[model samples]
Target: MSDVETPETAEKEELLTEAEKKALIALRRDEAAALRRWWQRLTLTPHELEKLTKQRSLPRGVRAVLRRCDSAEAAMLTQGFRELWAMLPESTKQTDYRDEQLQVWSCIALVAAELRKEESGVSLAKRLGQQKEQTGKPLMSELRFQQLLSCRTPEEFIQRLRRALALADKKGVSVVLLASVIALWWREHRGRLSAKPTQRLGFVLANDYFAATSGYSHRKD
Candidate 1:
């Protein structure tokens, strides 16, 4: 049998000083680009856009609010609608949201709520129940749209992310995957921010911090 590259073997491969296997932890510019673009097609089919892109306009009031702020995260929340809609149970798609923003944000919220499950070891239902208690109903409620829209300021945004990660189940979200999304999002909106040296996010800090002490284990040089 071939030795498939599970996380165990992959980490072992990273410890080896080989040029070809560096992509397991490449964390470089091109590698970061590869990571982010991977999410544009979470379902990975070209023919399904009709179902994904059919909704042309959000309700009038909802459109006005989303137009004001321009952040990479927001754009991802918007473009990610396709992936979100596809992943949902077909039975739930019939849910009648109270307003257009509520409908749109539902897709985004499902993704955000993922953070709560991915970052922790709790069960999915319990975490969601706690969230529901705060609103005095379930997450499916259109009024709970505020839970998703609460990220108006930096503090609230951080809390929203923190809550999702802190509360969700152990197998919840993929860290490497989210890292890739942010990596791509930054590239699209980087022009608005001040220029700086090239950067990589998510998994690089430890690799970078250990370079000197651990003898540059990930580099071929």
Candidate 2:
């Protein structure tokens, strides 16, 4: 093999790179769609959903760890974590993203415990913006939303996300959308430096929130 790349070799390499990028994109799309379907199935099956959400059905120890554990590692040790992981799509079970997946699972488990029911077909951020007080203000204030976006570490993100999920549950937001967004957020946050700036989770959320709130405000006016 030559030490230096020839022009023909370089062109072939670039084409291969493009093909790999397309394959990766397709894989991600399939994974996301699979996850959404999994959530939909869980929501449709009350008995199954109850096993994860109801305190009486879910073991006390597992529930406690999920609700209060300071780290994903601690949560992963519990039976609830394993059960939750088992319920996830196979495409999401890759060991390469083990830590990130565990954190996402932890958040999903916590939110599921609080979820009264699924409000499918709505984005989480839009649901938050749609929740209004008697005085016509968004239930999730801009400051709180900023706090969520500003979290610097996994611990901080988990803590703030717990509060946000609680609010979403109370406001009747879609748990399916909520979980999916949380997973997307973790993926984006972890690979943020390598990801295009325009494709950020924060940007997606901010746009959805503001657009919904703006529409709500106009309707109220």
Q: TM-score winner among the candidates?
A: 2
**Candidate 1 on 1-221: residue-level lDDT in tens?**
21111223343333223321232221232332222122222322345422433222222333223233243245334434433434333333554532332333332333332341232122222233333333344322223323623334433543444454444342344433333323222332333332432333222322322332233233345
Q: Write the per-residue lDDT of candidate 2 for residues 22-97, one digit (tens) a residue.
A: 3222124333333333343333354664443331233335455555666666667666556556645566787787
Top-lDDT candidate index = 2
For each candidate, give its TM-score against the true structure.
0.23, 0.66
TM-score of 2: 0.66
Lowest summed-lDDT stretch of 10 residues in model 2? 1-10
Candidate 1: Cα lDDT at 90: 37
Alpha-carbon lDDT, every model: 0.32, 0.56
